[model samples]
Target: MSGRVSHTVDMSVKLGELTLRTPVLTASGTFASGREFADFIDLERLGAVVTKGVSLEPWEGSPSPRIAETPSGMLNSIGLQNPGVEAFCEDDLAWLSSVDVPVIVNVSGHTVLEYVSVIERLEVEPRVDAYEINISCPNVDSGGMAFGTACTPAEEVTRACRAATSRPLIVKLSPNVTDIAEIARAVVASGADGVSLINTLLGMAIDIRTFRPKLARIVGGLSGPAIKPVALRMVWQVAGAVDVPVIGMGGITDTEDAVEFMLAGATAISVGTANFVDPTTVMRVTDGLAEFCRTRSIARVSNLTGAMRT
Candidate 1:
């Protein structure tokens, strides 16, 4: 009975040439290279592990009190803190190579050359299966949201990175843009194989008693359930605009949320803040996707993409 049920639905998804065993991926900056959550959930079960933002050099990041909890979500200004690309390969990549799942490195840099350099360095590493260019990070003072918010810069960065490596390139998009679909088109036209969004909305909070900003950065990126509606809208719009693939993420907390993204035309979905709430959120959503399809008699989960009725 179990064997028959398992074969009833196909959960595999393709993002460009990279094939994921399932459509569920962990959002960058949340899973921390998959090692921390390995004990809580099986790393092999994940469709792919997206590591935290890794720059060409180590980033000191923002000062303390960079995180704040709000009504239905949280704000953080981590500024893409990491041990740099070289150290990351020697340590995180080396360990991740042994795991059975695919590793998608999140590349970060202050310049277009820096982003290209990071990819060039990882090209020789056999463990890296793909690259997620994080041009949409809002916390950093420079190069984060700067490259992603506009078409010219977004295209320039995507074009440079595209020339750097043949590995699957997925550009992470910022929701702060005036028109996210335009940015998506810019990246895709510049040779991006896929695009992931909506990287936290620009948000802020104030400590009423102290009469000071809640976060040291004053304005940080807001994530979690608060942004779900906006995220879904952008995902739908981008998916309709782009021909490659759309990896949707933002406030996804459960199986139904994942389904909503797929129906909105997301080729794959990533779990961000939910991982902090429950380490097993990805696994649960992954399993739930299969069950969701099985019960609906949908032979493949891919069929769910863009299935929403007009």
Candidate 2:
């Protein structure tokens, strides 16, 4: 027999006051509250289930042909379509309450008041363990600028949500900004417990045959492996800039991708676009992480956070 010593690796991680069983979480908009993917994998196996963006009122969303495939990536402009917070509580939150895993609702709105309203509505629900403020939604009152793109608006929205609930607050930052770190700092200063980043880069595609734009909106949010490099860079920057935990997500598909993010200073990582390619990707990555740590005799997976060598 080989002289390899067995080791038990601890996968639990802490984000503010919240403790996650593992670092692997389901990115919002991809998992859809976890009920849809329950048949393929056990929901309890994930660190957390971040639900799709929910607003104060129902959003009609963008027109059809809002999706397009590109090299190593895909573009989408779904517009955060949802049945509003009240319906979400009646349906998604009700179902999630039965699951053992933590639920982090992705709150969206066109104004600061709308953001607070969504959190206030969800505050009554016992199922919600945390809140991931999706500031990627356009600020209609601010001339359509995404709340996550600017420091002032980002802080304004985050502060309002912070006052609305005492739950763990994590703001999802947009990559379509001049300096993502500045926006992250702004949100944290306003009272965000943690931050999740690289929410798809703005991109577009055109159909040569039809001589038209592939997506109906002319441009859409790009996700998948194409953005992994950019995502890693931003995670490194924001993680260093902020004292709070950083949830890195962009094109993570496997165990190595998750490891890379952790090394880049992410306290946790989220699986997004790859969920479409493999329904069991999150579980596979979660299990793989344990095996990876055991092989390295790391003892605990938390040691991998920001362990990168420059």
Candidate 3:
């Protein structure tokens, strides 16, 4: 047997100026408020927990048949369902605050005022470590254009959200745009602390027998291993263009996939759809990351960011 030193590898990472103990984190909406996977994995083992989209008021969500399975991915149009901010703070935050990990609240809205209102309400809460502005939601104020699809609206929304809170603000960008790098630059200039990208590609599916769309919404956000290449391409481009830390995500299911994103320039990664396949995914990723570092003799995991060669 070969003797390899059983040395400890450093896994801490920084998203902008926010230091995370590990680079592994759960994607918003997929992880909920940490209650769902508490029995399967320890919450503190991961870097952070990104809670589901929280709006100013309750959301009933979309109609039935909201999910459809594709060849290697899935489509979902859940419509940002969540209990209002008040209820979230009373129930979700109360429990999350007791946990050891940092909490990143994902805030969504149909209008600028709505987004600002939610931030104002949560700004003073000590349990909230950071805010992830969800600009992918359709803007009711802009005739249904997604704020993340345009640089102007993206900048406007980011500016409003940034002004409302002092905590580190991360803008989640939509892939359905002409130039993602331009949008990333716009938001960053408007005071975004960091950026997370390739939030599901817009896609759809139809049932051959029924002659109807698989999902009630007809079109939905597509996610899984199938989109890995697109996600990686976008992450690499944005990481090269932007100065702030980039949180890369979209179709990450294992440790190798996580490492690819880091090498592409992601300071951290959020595991999405995979959480549904395995509740213990976060625990496995965090441990597996350390193993990869140990085996490869990597002194610190942070060194992997932007290590890609030309």
Q: What are the per-residue Cα lDDT tens digits for candidate 3 across 1-310?
A: 0122234788889886678989998888898998989988889878999999898999878787988999889998888889999999999999997799999999988888989999999987899999998887531233123789988888998999988988999999888888899999999999999999868888899999999999888888899998999999999999999999999999999989999999999999999999999888877778777888898889898989999998
Best by lDDT: 1
All-Cα superposition RMSD per candidate: 1.4, 3.1, 2.9
Higher-lDDT candidate of 2 and 3: 2
lDDT of 1 by residue, 152-234 (tens): 99999999999999999999999998899999999999999999998999999999999999999999999999999999999
Candidate 2 ranges with C-alpha deviation above 4 Å: 1-7, 137-145
lDDT of each: 0.93, 0.89, 0.87
Q: State residue 54's C-alpha deviation in candidate 2, in Å.
A: 0.5
For 83-142, candidate 2 gives per-residue lDDT tens digits of 999999999998987889989999888888988999999998999999999886432233
For every model shown, what is its TM-score relative to the native structure?
A: 0.98, 0.96, 0.95
Model 1's TM-score against the true structure: 0.98
- Model 3 spans with C-alpha error above 4 angstroms: 1-7, 138-145
- The lDDT of model 2 is 0.89
Worst 10 residues of 3 by lDDT: 136-145
